[model samples]
Target: MIKVSEALAIVAENSSNMPVQRIPVRKALGYILAETLYSPIDMPPFRQSAMDGYAFIHSEKHQYDVISTSQAGDHSNIKLNENEAVRIFTGAFVPKNADTVVMQEHVLANKDSILIAAMPPQFSNIRNKGEQIAKEEVVFEANTLITPAAIGFLACLGITEITVYKKPKVAILVTGNELVKPGKKLPKGKIYESNSVMLEAALQTIGINKTKVYKVKDNLKATKKALKGILEKYDVVLISGGISVGDYDFVKDALLANGVEELFYKINQKPGKPMFFGSKKDTLVFALPGNPASSLTNFYIYVYPAIKNRMGFSDIHLPKLVRKLNDPITNTTGKTLFLKALYDETNVTILDGQASSMLNTFAIANSLLIVPDDVEGLKKGQLVTLLPIN
Candidate 1:
């Protein structure tokens, strides 16, 4: 067995990148940018009016002749002379030699001229050229995740398509003879398999879709055949059950026989110590424990980071913070423990039913309280690191 850090390092070294694809910028939200993006031209492309008012040279004059009116999209060449003003609306092009604009409310209207109620400062109501973005400026770097605001910025630059990291194709193989699908009649000594659905939901939460699920009996031949097929297709393979050292455990042997190089077999972590990770070429393989909670926990801790790194994500790990424990907790498993807990502003409350086979604690928990292997227990009000799930 390896330490949790060592297991994570191995996962980091084993991840593989999917090919980049050029996608329409409108449909690229949540995808990582594969290339650096630069603005093609100055944002706004012209000096624009920031508000509805008069456009003229700022001076001490009390009145000016109203030459013409300029609204948005009025590109007619209009130059302002001394003591002359143009009635401009919001987003309209500011006329040449116009240095200021006073609000309409600040000016008294006259038939052919306008009287200034207040003197306006120079360039007061104009959005200067390239104020938002300069031409050829690097606005977004590679590996940056595209958000709604990024889409708008790209549209302003006239960029309709962008190169982004392609999402990985995933395949899940749930192995167990006594496992039955949900909504089916449960026979004796059988439990409804949940690792597949839990894993599917976890993947989607991280913006990863395009997943397929398969089931196989606990037979070595069948497991080997299933593993081989999935390995050939999917970039990431998540297999639940048949990983521990049990009589029916056959996933490890099948993976090894199918040329999946073992990166590490076990980690010094409670709930998911039997987890196994390997890879063949650009494909990553994870053999998670059969327990529902263990599989999901391992996915969040190990699998999620690897997938994110492959998709050109820089912040691959979940956010972590230190919080005081509401109550004392003990760890007797001689491994690092991940306790399901609810976190408020200052403290975290550990929930019950933390057994690997149980999912009740996780349903209501928003964070995982980390209990290091060196610590025997934590006293009330003691600080511990926590990772949020929501």
Candidate 2:
């Protein structure tokens, strides 16, 4: 078994970025930019009115003759003379000779002229061309995460398409005879399967939607066949259950039989110590514990980062924070503990029902309090490392 840090390092070393694809910018939210992007034209491309007002050449005057009326999206070429003004709406192009704007509410309008209520500053309501971003300026560097704001910004700059690292194709193979699909009648000792659905939603939260699920019995041959088929078609395979040394557990054997080289079999971590990480060529595999809490915890701590790294993200791990503990907690297991907890910005509280099989606490958890193996426990008010989850 390896330490948690060692396991993470191994995952990082094995993960590689996916191939790049040019996709429409509108569909690129949450993807990693594959190439540096520069603005093709200045943002706002032309001088623009920031508000509905009178645009005019600045002069010390109580009134001005209205030359023309302009609304948003209009390209007005009417140049203003001294004391000349245009009735302009927000987003309208500011004529070249205009240097100031006065709110319509502040001006009293007569037939064709308006009286200014007070003097306005020059360039007060004008958004200068290239004020937000200049033409040919670097928009974003490679590996930048495409957020909604980024998409809007790119759209405003007239960028229709962007190159981004393609999301990975993933497969989930649930292995266990005791597990049955949800909504099915419960056979004496069988439990409704949940790891697949839980994993599917978890992957979607990270922007990965290309996934398929397979069910495999505890039989070694069935497990091997299922693993073989999924390994050939997916970039990553998440196998739940059948990884421990129990007589019915056959995932390890199946993986080895199919040429998956074990990089690390387990880690010194609670709830998920039976986890397995291996690779067969470019395909990565993670055989997680059968327990619900354990499976989901391992997915966030290990599998999530691996998938993100493969999608070209440099910051692949969960968002972290150093927050104070709201309550006391002990880790007598001598293994690194991942405790499901709730947290505000200041402090975290470890919740009840932390057993590996019970997911009650995990359902409400917004963060995972990480207790290192070297430490036996922590007291109330002591600061601890936390990994925030959705």
Candidate number with greatest TM-score: 2
Model 1 Cα RMSD, 1 decimal: 1.8
lDDT of 2 by residue, 272-347 (tens): 9999999999999999999999999999999999999999998899988889998888888889999999988788
Off by over 4 Å in 1: 116-120
Q: Go through the candidates in order and give each one's C-alpha lDDT.
A: 0.91, 0.92
lDDT of 1 at 118: 85
Query: TM-score for every candidate vs. truth?
Result: 0.95, 0.96
Clashing pairs in 2: none
lDDT of 1 by residue, 1-390 (tens): 999989989998778567999999999998999999889999878999998989999888979999999999888688888889999999899987898988898999887899989887777989988999999999899999899999998987899999999998899999999998999999999999888989999999888866899999998999999998899998999999999999999999999999999999999998899988999999999999999889988998999999998898998988998998899998887899988899999999999999999999899899888998888989999998999999
Q: What global local distance difference test value does model 2 have?
A: 0.92
Candidate 1 has an lDDT of: 0.91
Which parts of model 2 are misplaced by more than 4 Å? Answer: none
